[model samples]
Target: MTGGRTGWARVPAPVRDAGLVAVAVGDAWLAVSDSSWPEAGLAALACAALALRRYVPLVVVLLTVPATVVADLVVAPLAALFALAERRHDRRLLGACAVLMAAASAAPWPWHDPDSRDRTWTLIQFAYTLAGTAAPVLFGQLVQARRDLSRRLAEIEEAREHERALHAQAVLARERAQLAREMHDVVSHQVSLIAVQAGALQVGAKDTDAREAARTIRSLSVATLDELRNMVTLLRASGGRATELTPQPTLADIRKLVATSGIDAELTGVLPDTVSTPAQRAIYRTVQEALTNVRKHAPGAGATVELWCEGDDVGVTVTNGRPTRPSLPLPGSRQGLVGLRERAEILHGTFSCGPTPDGGYGVSVRIPAQPA
Candidate 1:
């Protein structure tokens, strides 16, 4: 491409030179009548000016316009047209050159013969003509250059935005994988315990503690499943990674959950079974904590867990019937209910708690689930 451009640039030089020689010869013939200066000297200077028109156009104008004045003060002065084309940048110079050229063209008729002077001032016409000819071409070049620069800047900004987005996505993916890994480690280990206990109970049906442990394992497993589902939903909705979105058992799953808690309490679920895991986990956790509460608040009262996954969502109620007496120090995390609400909020779910009409503590959750 460079070589091709070089070749093209070379092609114009010879043509320009030939055109210059032609203009100088034509101007010289017209000027010879003036005989104001030696012909050889004038011709040499004119030839040089014409030849160098492309590069030193101002100089060409300086030399040639005065020469044209001598040669065609009345006929057809011409050097300023080339001047207008070459040095368009200096308006002041352009005006001066224009006035001189026009004066030269019209001068011969007046300076040589007053009766022949029709118009010794055609510079106004020439000036107007020059502006009209150059404005659009120069304006177009300027506009094109601006547009090209704007387009390149826009492209660069878009590339930067794309790179930033890709980088953010990569970071999110890495964090998601890390979260999933952590969840898998925690929940899978819990499930493994449940499965192993089930296997143990199945193998030794005669052991009471094993049976109880098996039941506990079942409760733990059910709760674990619900908690895992809730955890996943949270991970996903929060832009973490819920790619494996699945319905989590809500209050409806608590009966099975508590039945597996290894405690001697009746776990009931009056609510529908389509409970979402976040809700179910909330309820399960409530019962789990209530049981823990019972162990601390009233270890001797028999406990009953009733879950209602009905209406807008699920409700969990735990009553220990006055707990038989007061005690201290629960066997589990004391912040269970707080954690439950925290979990619910994480899922964009709602939670409520207080005493039920029957005097038992009631925990209610309204999440994304069909009523019973």
Candidate 2:
């Protein structure tokens, strides 16, 4: 490409060069300031500007234009016509070129042509020279606009690609979360069953007093196994279709959750019919975590759970009766509520858990119905 461009540049436009020659010759070049230089020599000097016109259009106009104008009055140097035509689009060049032509034509000079109607010809020549020089500036402006538009288009494409990458990242994150939810549903149930069966085996190793404990273990095991099977079946299915995972538990699932805690409880509230699945899950986990804490910290105490929606908001509050005796172990992941509040805040929701004035502990979480 470099070689080809160099070759093209060297291959001069003969028509333009020839035009310079003709114009310079006819102008009868005279010394611009002195008005005495040999006509032929003056012509040679002005015509030289043509060769460098492409690289130095403004300069070429500036030099030849004044020289031709001054020479023209003594010689009416019209070679400036060529300079005007060559860079006619440039306003500054045209102005300089025009001044030269007027001077050259107006200066006293010998009129040689039989057709010389001096006044009329000089007037017409001046007008044409001015118009031609204005050309280069106009053309340059057009070229600049095209380049600006191209640059803007390239920037827009880059911005679009940036947005696309962000979108892809968001989709991938959502998919991973769905997979995690599926995994937990399956594993938690199996773990629960194992715990129950382990308890049963431990109890059955003893006497008649152990029968009641064994039966309790068996019941817990059966319930756990049932939950585990449903979770796994839904996950293994392909084609993005399923049936058994149908009604994943919601806040309403808290009744069974509290029952598992073995605590007497009351639940009341109206949950929104339309809520994002994540928000619903957050609520269930909150209640489940709070109740588990209650069972561990204040076991025989009663708990009151209330959940409902008001307009576009869903609220949940769980409070447990105070512990009369202080020796029970904490039943929940002790640090879990901190993580839970961080989760709620991400959706612009509120979460609070602490001891209330009545001596019991309470947890409250409110999420927007249409949370992001």
Candidate 3:
């Protein structure tokens, strides 16, 4: 295991040096077994220099040169050459070291008497020398290549896992959004039914207490409805929170909304029966939110809702006089106005809301009757 900056590169220096020392000592034993004790000492010293092969490759190679020239001691120098190739992929330096080691392996042959320097012996010696030098360099390069490939593969696998995690998160978000929308639809429908029943009870009750109780139920229902609508708006604005498939309220449903609001509200002007469903829904929601605000902020203050078509555009204006009696304002996020403005802008229309000169609150929205 060896590479540019990983694999064997991560091995501690001490451990690496110890491993090289072991290899050098084994080589010395093999070389010195048949040689003189002094030659054995020199071979062992040359091999020991390999302990610092990675730290001082050139120096170790030089130290091993004299031993190799005299006794054919090669293991330590071969190890040094391998370390050099792993550290620096310099072809010229590698070629020079290879040639020097090969020449040392061949030097012993020329010194043999002329009778022993036969052509067959010369070829065998040359081939053996080249294999010894070339084997370490080529083997080191092969190991480095495999280590580098393994690292790249690991990196690619890590990137792929990251992308998969992101994709899973996105899918989960979409599912959550769908759940939110479903919950809003189910809760809102039930709450509206409660409000409608309470309104009917208020209208029919003969006793004062019964009527008051019905009014309280109606008021609470309307407040809950407003809160629900705000929740839906927030979810819609947020990404990957929910999806909705429930039937949306249109201009026809405006009557029921105003009727059950428990506020004095007047609906005026003509609402086109043939308007697009989106425009009708927008108009219906605007009036419903405005009526809710009137009940919460301007209790007992009569409000007016005007719906009209102007050429290519349809419009709705909800205006209410200031509160006639002191009223405890209902808790709200005040996102209704923001939602209305966004609705208008999305249809390339205009929306405005503020206090009028007469101290009344007014909200006006104009959207395309038919989307362009």
Candidate 4:
């Protein structure tokens, strides 16, 4: 039954209207008698008026009344009444139309003269017609109610799906915040202790080799602490509002970052202050990650950090010379460059990292001076 209704609904509106008009005309044809010109004209008017039932249902029902009064026309008036009932919500108006249709169907023609018995039969027929008229009106109202129910159910389902999505996002945000707290409280504390211990060992060590080892450990621990703090800030923010948990790096920090990188790196060039905070942060991070990689993967390598700008474009480049000594085998997650690339893409910029022509590595990122 549902499939049948769906198929019927798929029929074009004009086609359905044409089909109803055809059915109404056929009903008029079957009922009209003796080629009576006036009756036939009235019937035709009622049937043709069915074509406009969707646009003016009340007017169509009124137009069908003349044919019902003059001839035994059923389909035209009933179809119009049904259309009126489906679109209108006023029960009083529908009831009035039903009464009018019944009266029109029951009345004797003007040419007819009725006796007592004929009058009695006419009254009985009137009651029967009145009762029958209720069918189309009631059926149309039912169809209207069903359509409303279907629409309401769809709205409710959409709201429920939206609520479920919001609940899932809220749960995920809470989890990220909890993870950030754990890293800050536990992992950060441990790394801070390691850095402090390494610094103390470096200060008191008597042998040259032990002092150098302590210094290296202290520098790595401090760098790890810096990265961990940044990670915690990001997790706690959860891609929401800006956070003050850690001071975000800007262009001013680039020189300090290079100086403490534990690499013989040179910093040159300048960018205008018109550069956006996010763009500056991207520049700072690109230089930081490039230098860190140099220390980890290219021991004894000297690096050059250059800041430059062009028309509507500003960027940073970090290039390192070939390693003069063998690098230590240190475990790496290899996500730093990937993270830099993602950041660049977010800023509508470009990032590239590869070995240079001089047997060295170079990392470059270019971003807009003022992104929207």
| Best TM-score among the predictions, by candidate number | 4
Deviating ranges (above 4 Å) for candidate 3: 1-39, 45-142, 163-247, 250-255, 264-284, 302-316, 340-351, 364-372
Q: Which pairs, if any, clash in model 1?
A: 73-108, 74-108, 215-260, 219-260, 236-242, 248-276, 248-277, 250-280, 271-309
- After superposition, the stretches of candidate 1 with alpha carbons farther than 4 Å from their true spots are 1-244, 247-253, 273-304, 309-311, 318-339, 346-348, 352-364, 368-372
* TM-score head-to-head 3 vs 4, winner: 4
Candidate achieving the largest lDDT: 4
- The parts of candidate 2 lying over 4 Å away from their true place are 1-57, 64-120, 166-248, 261-279, 292-302, 308-314, 321-350, 367-372
Alpha-carbon error at 108 in model 2, in Å?
8.5
In model 2, the number of clashes is: 18
Q: How would you order the candidates by TM-score, starting with the best?
A: 4, 3, 2, 1
| Model 4, span 1-372: residue lDDT tens | 122367778899999989998998888898896658999999999999998988999999999999999889989988999999999999999999999999899998875789999889889998999888988999999999988887788889899999999978887776676556445544554555566557657878999999999989988987897788678778866732222234467899888878876779999999999899889877887887787778767877899999999899999989999998766444443446765776687788999999999989999999999985
- Which pairs clash inside model 3? 177-241, 177-242, 177-243, 178-242, 178-243
* Overall lDDT per candidate, in order of appearance: 0.54, 0.58, 0.74, 0.82
Candidate 1 C-alpha error for residue 57, in Å: 18
TM-score of 3: 0.57
Candidate closer to the true structure by TM-score (higher is better), 2 or 3: 3
RMSD of 3: 7.6
Return the lDDT, model 3, position 177.
53
Give the Cα error of residue 82 in candidate 3, in Å: 4.2
